[model samples]
Target: MKVYLAAVATGLLLIAESANAISVNVQAGRHFTHTSAAIGDNSAGLSFNGNWARSDHNGQLGSLGTAFSLPVGPLTASIGGKALYLSPKDGKNGEALAAGVGLSWTVMPSLALYGEVYGAPPRLTSGIDSYAEAAGGLRFTVFKPLTVDAGYRVMNMRGKEGNRDNKLADGFYIGAGLNF
Candidate 1:
């Protein structure tokens, strides 16, 4: 846990020092928390994220990713890939390279809706058969550089031996973000 936190902090610091635009986000649910930091403009950027959960079943997950976004009118489309690491308390640890697509639409000047999905096939994964995640939410900009959001996320992993299929996290979360 400490190592994860340190890694995220170091990544964020490096991004802050070199990027003109940066965003940091934090989300929390009943049994899990997610955090991410990114550097880049709306058109493209690199991001680092970490998730931690504590429950009857829990784990830690992290990813480093990059995205290219295209804006058309009031909507944006993005394509990205992430290098993921998962360590579950009761399952095998694994690593995957996943591809993802995302879309976001501006509902109003201060509100927007967004969703994304990521998946990895057996060929791109190790110590696991596959990995998948889906998430969506509404974001409300409270001010120029601050925003709040509510969202739901679900993540799954299939074990190599077909014995440790796990729902890493499946729940709703509320989060806040800072942009600069």
Candidate 2:
């Protein structure tokens, strides 16, 4: 599992390094009691976003694959697909892919509200049955090249254990991220 995770992370890093426009994101969150954590579970991840096009009506721009954003009146609608690596502490760790779509509304020049959902089916990741996640939050621009975001995320994963349905991770989480 460690080898698998290292390989996946290396692949993602290589892809991001060669991408046209790239950004690095770091996020941290806490899981609820319903999750696998006995006392409290804390989750964190680093992601590299790359190959972004210009943002226009029906255009492709932002993080993930083929990301695009459009200004619908005063709101922005965006969607993208992402392939990710999973290294859960309580389950079989592997790789998975997710297709995500989101909507964002800018309340002010530096503040925006957004919500997104991502889903992956069985067999998408090795040794995993299925996974799904959803998040909603607010983002605030603190400086020109820096942004801060806080959100609530819910994630569920089922592991492949022969005929047994192993619930790996499931519950709500509160997280924060830095985008640059």
Candidate 3:
């Protein structure tokens, strides 16, 4: 994991900044895995999907950061981080910090293929481990301000004692978003 993070951090530092516009996303969904905090198992609220998206796993209460959508040769890149305040339904408080990089290819004007890689280490000690996830999916712009995202994600987390034999936990993600 250390090597993976070092590689990504180094790559981000080397990539040339380009002319890109900023967009923000705020959506709410079910909490799975380490996301128990912020948005409990059965809760609905705002989610972070903006500049600091990569860093913010679920929706830490107070999180702030910046990310970029850069245009590569034929695909776009997503890079950013977020630090959120964690508050669970069981009266637990902590923080989750994350960083990620993704790529998107627009095959058509309104349709695109996307993939992302996320690595986030929690700051609080509530039985969560440093995790990493990779996913791919399809995105379609339904309207001028509406978009849909459907994807499957595979992730791995350090088990009880940072052992590597534990089975990884991943899930499928399907939903829509609005651009304002």
Highest lDDT among the candidates is held by which one? 1
Q: What is the C-alpha RMSD of each candidate to the true structure, in Å?
A: 8.1, 14.2, 13.6
Measured by TM-score, the strongest candidate is 1
For each candidate, give its TM-score against the true structure.
Answer: 0.82, 0.58, 0.53
Better by TM-score, candidate 3 or 2: 2
Please list all clashing residue pairs in model 3, or write none if there are none: 51-67, 55-82, 55-98
CA deviation > 4 Å runs, candidate 1: 1-19, 43-56
| lDDT (Cα, tens digit) per residue for candidate 3, span 67-123 | 566676557776766654434322344455768777788888899898877666645
Question: Candidate 1 at 46: error in angstroms?
Answer: 6.8
Candidate 3 is scored at a TM of 0.53
> Of 1 and 2, which scores higher on lDDT?
1
- Lowest summed lDDT across 10 adjacent residues in model 3 is found at 36-45
Tell me how far the alpha carbon of residue 1 in candidate 3 is from the true structure, in angstroms, after superposition.
Answer: 57
Q: Any runs in candidate 3 off by more than 4 Å, and if so which?
A: 1-64, 86-93, 121-127, 154-169
